[model samples]
Every structure is written in structure tokens, then in C-alpha cells.
Target: MKSFFSNQFINKTSLILLSLFSFSLTSCLDKEGEAPEPTPVAYVTLYHGAPDAPEFDILVDNQRLNSQPFKYNNYSDYLRFSTGSRKFKFTPVNAANSYVDTTLTFKENKLYSVFAVNRLQDMEVLVVSDTVMTPAAGKAGMRIIHLSPDAPAVDVATTGTTGTSITTNLNFKEHTLFKDVATGNQTIQIKRTGTNEVLLTLSDVALTAGKSYSLLLRGFQTPPTGNTNILSGQVVTNY
Candidate 1:
């Protein structure tokens, strides 16, 4: 019999890429012609958060995962993958040398986001789970992550600190737990910690009922010549 991992893969041909809060169910058959036990599976997404890094190709267990070179600030839809010890490699597009080589276990039935973060010199993979309490009636869930490598500590708020705090003192690579908030449009500001100096402001941001989101603080505070984008906030739908 072909043991699991040797002949096991989601969606048969490969991974099942799901979007937002979604799931895909599939089964496999053993070499004996009988249905095998259900293999543990998980959902994962890849993100290129390294602004100054070259385009990369993602590989898992010696298999190429992305058809195109994953570019800077881009992210892939959640893909269903087999659970257990998995090796990941990120190499420059069409290049033989890998910039990142790491491994992480994916627990069964969990959601994950794998980020290639920081500048090229300090690039690394940062993985995080995507589970949160369900939003109550008329509310939405949200959280913020600080991913700008060269950025100073910051705070995110709708109004001045006090009771309007969404996140505080969030440093590079730091992420906040999901918090439920009232649904509607509101302004968001990324300010220097403990002060009113705003670095970036988002206007009329919408939070829909019964949904969740991840607010990413990415890019460079002082972008290099080749990369012109400055510090900004990106919203990723979690569910």
C-alpha cells in the first residue's frame, strides 16, 4: 500500500485553493482499491510581504506550489494541504538558490497564513493561525499585524488612544488578537506610539457584519529606489 504523504494530496491533482472563510472536502483511495482513512488536512495561504525581495517560487516537499513567481506584497488564496511535517522553500524565480528554507507542521482542519516578510536581507517565513471567536450579532471581527521591517512601534486607532484603541505599541511582525467591533464605515489611523503623529490614515473603511479581517501594516517607511511604495495598510479577508 502507498503510505500517506507518498500518494496523498488534496483535490487529487493538487491543493484545493479556497477563498476567504471556506472549506473543501475530498477523500482518497488506497492502493488496495478500497477507500483510505480520511487524511488530516489544513488550509494555508502564501503572502509576499517582503517589499524589496525578488519574485519567488514556493515549494513544498520538493513540489512547486505556485505556477507564477510570487511577487512582492501579493498573497495567494487559501489552499488545502495535507497535514503533518511539511518542508517549505522559497527561491528566487527561476533561480537555483533558495532564500528561505524552513518547516512547520499544519494541524488538521486549521487555517494558516504563511508570510515571507521583512526586507531581502532579513527575509524569513512567519506563520500564524487564523482562528477567532465568531462575531456576535451586528458585529465584525478584525485584527492588525505590524509587518513593516524598518518601521517604528505604532498604534492603530479610530480616534485618540483612550477608548478607541484597536491596537497599541505594535512592533514589527507583531499581530493583535481578533476583536469584535460594530459594523459600519470608519476612519483608521496608524500613529506613532504614545503620540498623535500619524504616519498613515485610512478613510471610510468598511467593516461588514458577520465577517473577519486581518489588517496588515506593510511596505517600507522609507522605500528604496526600486520599490517606491511607502508604508501602508492592507486588508485581508479572513472569513
Candidate 2:
């Protein structure tokens, strides 16, 4: 009877240990099958005009990314992105002679930059992207530049689904630049400072996520003639 009791106790202990081992193994297997979070990618792009135009210096978030001119035209000049947000500034060797500087923004998985020159009296910047469109966010990422031989006052206004206006006075022969715009559809209205007379108005503008745009406004006001303005091409996106 003593031997049988000992044997029974040993069997129960062995069964309990086996069950514990099985449970641990199952738990480890479940953990192995669990999905992991995806890693974020930085999407960086450069948007500049003059595809046929000469290549110039490029600075990303104040860091020199490219010193030489890009090899392709407008479409090919844009850079591909990977991940992270970046601030970019492109200045041509002869900015005064060149049409304009390259303006763009770098955001996670999305980056766009565009460069163009001023031909007419007006200049414009068009923001385009494939990401979602949020007006407030889009406008926060945009920037604009105004150059004039004679420093003339400038004013900015948004005319679209939302009408927002801003005005500023520019010094003579001064170049004005505005930055940090939100994402969405809007317009920029430029007028001479101290005067209600409209100097230039950019309409049907689209601001997109992960993208950047630049505009060059040249020419100053003359006795009767107002300031010369330039308008950017349309910014199209799936959003």
C-alpha cells in the first residue's frame, strides 16, 4: 500500500509538470506569430523649375545635400524620399539673374520641391502631392518669395473655400519670403502696401502634404503700372 501511494503521487506530479510545459510552449508560439509594427520611411523629393535649367546648390534642412545641378528636367530633377521631416532651401549661384529659388518641404514618406522663374509681372508657387488634403496643415508648410527691383510693399490673402488675408511692407529692392503653410486649396492675393490696389492674385492653388512649392515675384510698381506678378501651374493630386 505504501508503494502504490508513492507511485500515484509521482504520476500526478509528472502530469502537472507536463501540463505547465505545454502551456509555456503554446504561449511562446503565439508570441512568435504576433505581427510587428511597420517601420516608417522618409519620403524626400526636390521640386525645382528649369529642367532644362542649370543645376545649382541644394540645401536640405540647412544641410548641403547636393552641390551640383540636377541632371534632368523638371520631372526628373525631383528627389525620391525615404522617411522623416526635413526643411530644404535651394539657392542658385545667380539668384538675381535666375528665375527663382527652389522651395519645398520634407515630411515623413512625402517630400516635394518646385522651382520656377518669373516671366510676366507675376510669380506663383503650386503645391502638389498624393497624400491627404488638410487645408490648415497644408498652409502651415508652404513658403513664398517676392523679389523686386524697387522695394514695393506686398500683401497676401487667401481666396477660396476659406478667405484669409495678410499684408506686409517690403523695402526697396528687397526680396520677401513667407514660409510654413498649411495643406489644402487656397489663393494668395498680393497688393501694394498702404494701398488697396491689388498688385497680383494667385488663384486655384492647391497645397498638398509631403510636398513643397516655390514662386518668384519680380518687378516693382511704376507710376501707373502696378507690381509684376507670376502664377504657378496647377498642383494636381489624388487627395
Candidate 3:
């Protein structure tokens, strides 16, 4: 009778221990089934000049983001970016005098604004894009302008073998325009009809097939003593 009681007790104890172990294993498996959450990212926007003041070029770091054909009263001249700390520089292409280069340390997911002094009309930048194409295929292009505070609208004409004529009119602001062009190395000359000034001359521009290029044109400034014209603008390429 004693042996039989001992055996039954041992069996019950073993079963209880096995059940507890199984419960622990099931709990662990349930915990392992869950997925981890993703980390958040930031967004940034950059604007040139004061919010109420007129500006020509909007850049995110060294990259030329937007140029205005006329003075936009709203948020049209802003560039957006993902969140993080970034360093930026803003240079006025068409200012009367060479302004000090401005730089900013930016935070992700935030908005910033910079300003230009001694404004000149028709400031812009050029960019190139990467869309694969054959040399014999068509081309892509972009246009830009700089508008002065009270200058008249300027007309643009493009003389190149690859792209169409850029006849867009720009007011007192910076404008970045885009278009499709032919593929090859090309020379482009931009002339202002009223002043008959060859505002810009770009030579040996490598325009690839199926790619987009941006051309930035800031305003022109006259010499201090004479009536001669001096060109001041910035150009950049983007893929």
C-alpha cells in the first residue's frame, strides 16, 4: 500500500512539472511572434530671402531647388527634405555686390529661410538628370530666371542644336524651368531681347540622352563707372 501511494504521487508531480514547462515554451513563442517598430525620419524645407521679402534662388544645401520667374507671395520658393542635421549654403547669383556666403546648420523635418541683398534681375541655376538614353535619342532640359525688385519682365531665347528655344518671360524673381532637349554636347546662349545682352553663354554642356538639365540665370549687374554689363549667376546639375 505504501509503495502504491508513493508511485501515484511521483506520477502527479512529473505531470505538473511537464505542464509548467510547456506553458513557458508557449509564452516564449508568443513573444517571438511580434515584429519590431520602425524608426522615424525627419523632413526639411528651405527658402531663400525673408518670408515677406523677395528671393530668387531656393537651395537645400548646395543643391539648387527652386528659382522664381516672378515674385511669389506664398510658399512657392521652398524646398523640402527628410529629417536630420544638414549644412546649407545660399549665394545670390544676381546681386549688385558680392554678398557674403551664408550657411546654416539645419535640423530634420524643419523649415528655414535665407535672404539676398542688392538684388539683380534674372538669377538662376542649371541641373542635369539621369534618365538613361542612347546618344541618337531625344534630350531633356530645364530653364531658370532671376527677377529684380522693379525690373521689367525679361524674355529668353535659346540658340542650340539640341533643344528648343526658351522664350519664357520672367518677372522680378528666380525661376527654374524644365524641358526635353536633344542628346549630345551642345552650346547654349541666352539673350535678353530688350537689352540685347547675351546674358549667359554655356559651352560644351554634356547633355545625355533621356536626361534632364536645369539652367539657372540670375540678374545682371552693371559696372560701377561704365554702362557695361557683368554676369553673376550660379549653375548646378542634378541626376
Candidate 4:
């Protein structure tokens, strides 16, 4: 009878230990599968396109931007922010009141660009959802924006020697959808709508595969006497 009791105790103890070991292993595996929370953020860039407007400062949720006031034709690099709704205020330099105020909601991991456009007193912001997707192998993406308030409607095409039209009839304050192009040195010619007269020619523009870009045409086609603003073109790396 003593031998039977001894055997029973041994079996019970072994079973309990086996169960505890199994439970411990399962807990460790559960921990291994779990990961830390991911950080949520959005990317944005700013452009100053308003002619006749002075330099301006930016405030987000009442917090002033760290950079200096943006002057005409100025652009900022991509800035990071937490993903959510935030208020944006644009104030002229040394001014107490804001020139423009609006609320913007941004999604995590997305890219955006904001442009301060038009003349002062009629100034407005244009927000563009930027695509950061890599183009196909050996291809690049290009987009054009016409921001010259006094310029005529125009078409953008490859140089007279090669390629084809990329955008047509792009008017003031208009922007084109992104178009994929072969990656290499490129030339673009801008012409007035329904006419063959080339208004601008961009020579030897470099394009790289898997990259995106934006070309902006700015300023007045014909400025008043003594006006310092001249018609110009600029390119920006989007991603």
C-alpha cells in the first residue's frame, strides 16, 4: 500500500511540471510574435507662388514653423508631422494677424504639397496629394504646374527633335497629372495654345529612374514697366 501511494505522488508531480513547462513555452512564443507599435507620420512640402506678396511665416496648431519666413518663389524640403487633423495659419512677416487660416487632415505615410498662390488679398492655398510610388524600371514620373497668373494657356512637349506631348492646354493655376517617361537627359518645349511659337525651352533636363519630379512655370508673361518679376521656370524633386 505504501508503494502505491509513492507511485501516485510521483505521477502527479511529473504531470504538473510538464503542464507548467508547456504553458511557459506558449507564453514566450506569444511574446515573440508581438511587435512594438509603429510610429505614425506624414510628409509635406511648402511652396510660395504668390507674386507681389511679401515673405510669410507658417504656424501649425498655433505653433510657429522653425524655418524662416518664405519669400516669393521659395520652396521647402519635405517636413514631417504626426498624422491627424491640424490647423494651418499663414501670416505675413512682422504681422500680428494671419493672412490665411485653414484646417488640414493628413493620412499616415502619405505625401502632400501646399502652394500659396495668387496675388495678395486674393491669396489661396493649393494642396496636392503627391505620389511616391517608384516608377517602372528605367522610367520616371513628371508633372507640370502652371502658376504664372498672367501667362496664356500652353502645351508642353518634347523638344522639336524628339519625343511627344506630355501635357496640353495647361492654363494658369492648373497642374497636370503625372506622366511616366523614359529616364535620361530630356528637353521640353512650351508653346502657346493652338500656336507653334515656343514660349520656353528647357534643355538637358536630367531624369532618373524610380524618381518623381514637378516643373513649375511662374511669373508674368508681360510685366508692367520697371517690374522686376520675370517669367521663369523651376524644377523640384518630389521624391
Name the candidate that leads on lDDT. Answer: 1
RMSD of 3: 22.2
Q: What TM-score against the true fold does each predicted structure earn? A: 0.84, 0.35, 0.42, 0.78
- CA lDDT of each candidate? 0.78, 0.43, 0.41, 0.75
TM-score rank, highest first? 1, 4, 3, 2
Give one digit per residue, the lDDT tens place, for model 4 in 1-239. Answer: 01111344434433432343445556666466675344466777778887767788877776666345677888866666656776888897767687789888888889888888876777888888887667678888888899888889999876645486789899988898778876678888889988998888888889889888898888777865765666777877787
Candidate 1 vs candidate 3: the TM-score winner is 1
Per-residue lDDT of 50 in model 1:
90
* lDDT of residue 34 for candidate 3: 63
Alpha-carbon deviation at 43 in model 4, angstroms: 0.9
Worst 10 residues of 2 by lDDT: 230-239
| CA deviation > 4 Å runs, candidate 1 | 1-34, 160-163
* Best model number under TM-score: 1
Model 4 residue runs over 4 Å out of place are 1-39, 224-226
For all candidates, the clash counts are 0, 43, 39, 0
Against the correct fold, how does model 1 do in TM-score? 0.84
Ranking by lDDT: 1, 4, 2, 3
